[model samples]
Target: MAVITGGTRGIGLATARLLAAEGADVVLVSRNADEAVRVADDVARTTGRRVLGLAANTTDDAAVGAMADAVERDMGGAHILVNCAAEPAGQKAVPAPSEAQWASLASHMDTKVMGYLRCARALLPGMRRAGWGRIINVSGLGARRTGDVVGTIRNVAVVALAKNLADELAGTGIAVTTVHPGLTRTEKVDAMLEARAKAEGHSTAEVEASMTQNLLMGRLPTAEDVAQVIAFLASPLSVTVNGVAIDVGGGVRGSINY
Candidate 1:
């Protein structure tokens, strides 16, 4: 079974759907109980697979623990964990950031960095008992580029956390990895495009074109595109690929990551 935090939308929801279609039961977790249950029912109906919607705030230790316990009791324990519960990044306006603006960094860290750790801690014992598991951290490309201080720090921290966990779990049949998705097409894209179009006095299509002009693929990846990579990493086929960051950005022009 797979437990996907932030599974009500975007990449998390996409991954849950894909995994369920592949015959694995799924638990969709989000802070909103109603939305979580609604989405889970929708996916379950579509895929004809068992899907449970769970409510928990990853930043709360007790809540995360309770979530894990509930999953074990309900689904017979989860063998896959996808940490995608962070707030959307790149929201901070950082032009000579004020002290007040700087304070938001801690909240980002608490959600993406420490929150990922908390979920992993709660689930690792069950994974160890099974002697096989997949832990995939849904980080972002902000870790590679600059400009977004909160995004960069929290994403980089996730990479570091995954690497350390991968090393610590070596020879234990559990793999931990991080995936960095660039500006992918998700539910938020339409509103974002509309706002950008209004700001620039251009058509939404034009604004979207400008955004993807530099991408080698000439288009933004859809949430499903990124989820395909996550599904692979969550599978036994990815046993040899651990502790590394995979970029699902559809290729950034003139920037090479070695």
Candidate 2:
């Protein structure tokens, strides 16, 4: 079974659906417990696999611990874990910003980076006993250093954590890796573009055009695009592939060491 945060929407939702399609029972975790269950049902119906949706804030340590226990009892111990939950902190103004805005970025880091740590620590015991596990962190393109301060830093921290975990867990059959998805075609991204356009006094098209112009493929990466990479890494085939960040951003100008 796979336990994924933010499993009700965007990349998280896509990842859950794809995993179910590939014959894995999934547990969708999110703040909205009701919505999580609904999405799980939808995934189960679509992929013909058992999907358990649970509402639990990723940042809540107790919540995470309880969910981990539930995962073992309800869906069997989660062999695969995907940390895709975030505070969604892509919004920013280039030149000037406020303290509250900075806190927002910190909050994003707390929910994701710290949340990943909490979940990994909680689930490691089961994985260690079984001698097999897969942990995937949903980082993003420009995670290394893309001129975007908070977002870039957050991604880098996640990638660093995954790499470190992979090294530490060597010979434990636990693979830790980060998948750096490029600009994904998601409602969240669209909303960010709209806000940016308004702030910059440009049309949404103009902002989008500028954003895509940097992509080698000239298009936003689809959720499926990143999901394919993640799906492979989660499989037994990628047991040897560890401590690496796979970039899914249409070959952007800046590259990170994988």
lDDT of 1 by residue, 126-207 (tens): 9999999999999999999877767788899999999999999999899999999999888888778898899999998798
lDDT on C-alpha atoms for all candidate structures: 0.93, 0.84
RMSD (CA, angstroms), candidate 1: 1.5
**What is the clash count of model 1?**
0
- Estimate candidate 1's alpha-carbon lDDT, on a 0 to 1 scale: 0.93
Best-matching candidate per TM-score: 1
Candidate 1 displacement at residue 90 in angstroms:
2.8
Residue 200's lDDT in candidate 1:
91
Stretches of candidate 1 exceeding 4 Å from the true structure: 97-102, 198-201
Q: Model 2 over residues 65-118: C-alpha lDDT tens digits?
A: 998989878766888888999876555453333323667667878887999988
lDDT of 1 at 86: 94
